[model samples]
Target: MYFPFRQLLASSLALTALTIPARAQISIGEPIPFTDTFSGTLLDDTFLVLTAWRTDTGSVNGGLFGRTFVGLTNEPVGEATVSAQSSTTAPNFFMARNSASLSVENAEAARYTTQSSHGTHTQVEFFTPTSLTPARTRFHWNVSGLTSSTYPGVVTNADLRFAAGYFPTTSYYDFFDLATQENGGPLMSVSGTGAFSYNLPLLLNQPIDLFYHTVAYVGFTAEGGETFSGFSDFSNTHILDRIELFDSNDVLISEWGMREISSGQVMFDQNGRTAAANGGNNIPEPGTLGLLALGGAALLGRVCRRTKKGN
Candidate 1:
């Protein structure tokens, strides 16, 4: 019995040496998708979708501080497009001195239009395409166009944008504050900043055949930007760079965007190399795959040795 136990332990150690780990990339049939083949899917290589929507101290005339969405697609994401904009302002307490909200103007894939020119403003909607494959998706909010003279609350630029993840069943907060000219309601006062997020979840195919919703809270604040309300010399615009999506592993799965700040409305750019473009399928590096295979073989060898000893 002692001899058999000793032989089993030896086999176990040998098996451990032969075992190899699996890569993070999804199999062809898996439901999730990748936006970019981030760092070739190494265990430590994670991906993130980045977009900027406003600049605090930069010129606003060139870019509109635009807003747009990235439709979710389970299939290998093909042709993709990115769009952003900046808008003119109107004078009003609802538009300025709000400090909590930014000026609102422009609309796309939405029915609401801009009724105010200079006060607080915003665009709200889910980025998830009405028809697309469902997975746990995350939307990245990128913001710019702020400074200590313009935004004082933040110590770093990365803290400017707001990232909110929402499920499917989440309810929308009405903008009644701006509507009724009251600060206590939904729409708050206007600041020099813009806010955005995509918290809605798309449909997923699974055992329950039920929906998996990921609702999120989206928007941004002026922090402590210079007050332009009740004054004409004060003016500003929020410019967004792009909206990005990621998978459960925190890997940047795919994105639909562009780098040109002054470019026209968002359109498909073939130059992007996000994972969605690669169909979330990538070849595992030989070094790592080889290690995993070796580990598996070692495990099998150990089991075989133990069986032989028992016999």
Candidate 2:
């Protein structure tokens, strides 16, 4: 379930000083699998933040960047309305799930400024509480979605974008604008079912955060006052049927199922027992990375704006 940023921040800060014990080095051919099928009524509590925003603007610095917080109360099924600068142009963006999958979409089209632009951005993140330093790692997942834009008039730019990947560290400045190096080399291109396995160049002992992000953007100059509409439609849906992780020899190192994630039992190892269960060790709590990243982005934006003004 989703927790408020304030509550999550407080808890994360309190646990910041705690240390996470490194897992025993997983050897090849040892089964230590981790898998997750979205069969639960709620997203795993390890998902610390869910956020979305829409913007309409006449100038780069003059857009109304409306932001919204998605709560766990509506999980397994819910939608939030993204308001545009104009009163008549509200669009509904939803993040819903059933016993089988999680879906994200913006059903209604957003209206763009007659001679400017409009866009929507959504992101969700999952925190890894433990440190995994396996010599070799394999990652796999599934997805199906589409984005479209309709401009009854003239247009200069239009596009829909989606990206999924993980951060090696718990801290980040921007979720949507992460540099390639920040996401562990290259970001995963999420479309159909895909998987990749690679050997580590060095031992990694810190926890990582997995993230999924999407953007629907359009820029146009209306002709004869004709309006423009655009959206990211995934009605067919994106399903995380299963996410499995394995070591070099294809042995399971750790696994997560919908039930375990939904219930916040995210700190488990190969034997299906949490660190606490193995002994008294506790996984390091994650900070409010989502909010912190957004704040950093805003600050960076302001800095860039001031520099532009100076020029």
Off by over 4 Å in 1: 1-173, 176-236, 255-311
* Tens digits of per-residue lDDT for model 1, 109-137: 21110001111111122233323323443
Model 2 Cα lDDT, one tens digit per residue, 1-311: 11111101112222223222223112221111111011111111222223222111111112112222222222221232222211111121211111111122332222121111112222222233335434333332333334344543312211111233333332211333443334665443332222322222222343233333321122222222333344333333332223344445565556332112222433333333343323321212322333334321232121100011110
lDDT of 2 at 4: 12
The CA lDDT of each predicted structure is 0.20, 0.25
RMSD of each: 28.7, 15.5
